[model samples]
Target: MDIDHPLALLGGLTPRRFMKRHWQKKPLLVRRAIEGFASPLARADLLALASKEGVESRAIVRDGERWRVKHGPFSARALPAASRRDWTLLVQGVDLHHPAAHDVLSRFRFVPDARLDDVMISWASDGGGVGPHFDSYDVFLLQAQGRRRWRIGRQRDLSLRDGVPLKILANFEPEEEYVLEPGDMLYLPPRWAHDGVAEGECQTWSIGFRAPARGELVRELLQRVADEAAEETSPLYRDPAQEAVESPAAIPPRLQAFARDAVAAALKDAPLLDRALGEALTEPKSNVWFESSRVPARLRGVLVDAKTRMMHDSRHVFVNGESWRASGRDASLMRRLADRRRLDARELAAASDAARALIRAWCEAGWLHETGESHG
Candidate 1:
């Protein structure tokens, strides 16, 4: 994707310009961003997905002054009828299951895949909404089906309502209001307070980006680093001079320093840190798993399934929850797959034998597929 070229998806502004001018700085409302945009999955289809155990879904309903929240796989009978009002079904990672949803998400490829998260669909009845709140990550809310009225502002007080399942803003101040019709989209950066209430029965697709909190990221990376440290064949403990501590209950100063140094040394290798980060970032959600299958003996072009999430950063390639170090031509090919999500026959043919073998292994593991072939 050309970052400098203007795209209709980015409101006729080049991604480069948008990133420089507005990204994480303010909000942008683009009309007709996706011309003739249609809901990729129908209401029934979305509900069907919500019923699947592997899919992540949530149901929210406003009952007078109170809001009710529930996890799903909710049966259709559990949901209020299509005619019922003030309820919503939210399905996460729609791009992982629906082709059209994936295609819609691919338009934002100008952003790096590592930061890109999955698309989520929210189906709401008239007057339905989760309530006024803010997200910690950036999001592009595109109206896919009916209409939605949005009220937005830069919030100062991020207080939540007491005793509600959703983190609704306690003091919402609206600076601007818009009723988004089909093809209308709104981009919001982290902590920009916004509320969307369905004008009628509506479907909205939120293309969200991942922004891991600093503390959370450090915790996850440290855990990964510790795991790697445990696998090392080096010395575990070294105490050449064992002197009895004056305070029996107290930890010796040397031991405390040694423990800190050990942790620091384990994380001292930049390459290992990078690899761990890549692995952690690309780790799939708990329910995500590839379907195992056999790859044909004859090699062919490879097509990554839209349902699978693949990503790479500086030092490693990540697919599902698995990670691998990429080097040489194989690294290049893996990077290509990370970028394009597919490789043609010519590209595969040009791959080194080791790379081909790796692809074959991935195919067998169901992480990849041979183009133009049925899985079954």
Candidate 2:
């Protein structure tokens, strides 16, 4: 992707321009962002996915003055009829379940993978909606089927209605409105309030990005860094030759300094912090799992499993919560695999004996798959 070239997806704004002007600062509505965009997952396919366990899904219905939501594995028999109005089913992480969905997700590679969350599919009947609400993360709402009328505002109240299953705004202030047709898209920065109601029936794909809160990141990183530091040969707390005239309940100043030094020591290793961050970023969601694998006798081209998350930093590569120290040619190859998600004949043949063994180990762990006969 050319950083300077205009993208129809951004409504003629270059990616650089979009990031500079609109990202996290305002909303953008692009008509036909994906020209003639038909949804990769059909309604029936979405329904089937919703019925499977390990997939996150939900059904929302409006009943007169009340609204309700139900968690799924929704059976095919459980879904409301197509003719039915005022009901919707949402399936999260569609990218992990279907190949086409993953391809659609790949379109947003302009953004870093660590920040990109999964694509969610929303299917609704006429009058269906989850009510007006704000997301904590940025989102691209791409209209893929039928039509949806959206009313939006930069909400300030940010209060939710009482006793509702959804976190709907109690005071929705619609400052603008648009009816999104097939291929139209709306980008909303975090906390931009919006509501969408199906015109008749619709499917919308939400490309969401993860925004880790400062406190949340602190907690995750501290835990990982502290665990790593524990493996180091640090001396146990020692307060030798102490004067015992003070209160027993009060922690000593020496102890406090020791505790502080422990934290400082954990942070002292910047490379450890990098590895921890990469591992945390690539960690799979709680619902994700992989099948057991075994190494083949001969090696070939390979592909990373769709569900596997891989990322790298200056000194190390991370995948599915595991970190590896990588350098030299092997590091370059691993980074390429992380970026492109596959290795071809020439790339595979270039691997050293140790690198080939590591690749075989990953294949045996189900992180990668052999695609063809071995060339080496």
Candidate 3:
């Protein structure tokens, strides 16, 4: 994806410009971001997905002054009739299970794969909603079916309602309103408050981006770096001259400083620290897994599903939590796969023998699939 290229999705601004100007800075509303957009999964299809054990889903219903939330795999009897109003079914990671949903997500290739999270589908009845809330991460909410009325604002009060299952805002202030039909999209930066109510039966696809907190990132990176440092060198405690103190309650200041300096020295290698950080950031979520299949010897072209998160930085290629050292033409080929997520027959032929072998391994692991195959 050319970040400099103008996009209808970014309101005619180049993705580069959009990222610099609006991403994480403010909200952006684009009409017909996806022209003629339709729900990739039918209502029944979504319900079937919700019935699966591993798929995350929730059913929300408004009953007068009260709201009810329930985990799903809900039977037909559990749901109100289609004509009934004020209920909703939300299915998370629709892109992971539906091919068309994944295809729709590929349009946002302007964002790096590491930051791009999953797409969630929300199907709501008339007057149904999850209520006013704010997300800690960026999101693109695309209306896929019927209509939804949205009230949005830059909220200052981050307080939540007490004793509620959902983290609803205690006080919501709406500065703008929009009734979105199919194909319209609203982009909200982190901490932007928004509420969407179904004007009627509707489905909305939310493409969410992950934003790791600073402390969480530091912890993960430190752990990864420590593991790498441990493998490289085994430093034993050196206390050549030891004296027993009359007061045995406290550690010696010299010993404390020595331990601190040792840790500091271990972390002093900037390049090693960066590599570990990259690896940790690209690690896949625990629940993610790929299907296994043998690669054809006469492989022609390969296609990576948009739901597959793959990334690379400098010395390593990271895919689904696994990291591999890459160099020469192999590194170039892998980088291309990371960028485009697909390779034609000619491109495959251009790869080195070692790179082809690596590709075969990825194919067997189900990271990459042979193009034109009937896996779907």
Q: In terms of TM-score, which candidate is strongest?
A: 1
Model 2, 1-376: lDDT tens digits are 5678899999999989999999999999999998989887788999999999999999998987599888999998887888899999999999888877787788877789999999999999999999999999999999999999999999999999999988999999999999999999999999999999999989999999999999999899999998887788888999886798558898889999999998897788888888889999999999998776766687668888878899999899898999989999999999999998889878988988898898888887777888852211
Candidate 3, lDDT over the whole model? 0.85
Q: How well does candidate 3 score on lDDT at residue 311?
A: 84
lDDT-best of 1 and 2: 2
| Range of the 10 consecutive residues with the lowest summed lDDT in candidate 2 | 367-376
Q: Once superposed on the true structure, which residue ranges of model 1 sit more than 4 Å away at CA?
A: 374-376
For residues 47-86, could you state the per-residue lDDT of candidate 1 as single tens digits? 9999999999999988998999999998999988878899
Sorting all predicted structures by lDDT, with the top scorer first, yields 2, 1, 3
Error of 3 at 16 (Å): 2.3
Weakest 10 consecutive residues, lDDT, candidate 3?
Answer: 281-290
TM-score of every candidate: 0.95, 0.94, 0.94
RMSD, candidate 2, Å: 2.7
Q: What local lDDT does model 2 show for residue 235? A: 88
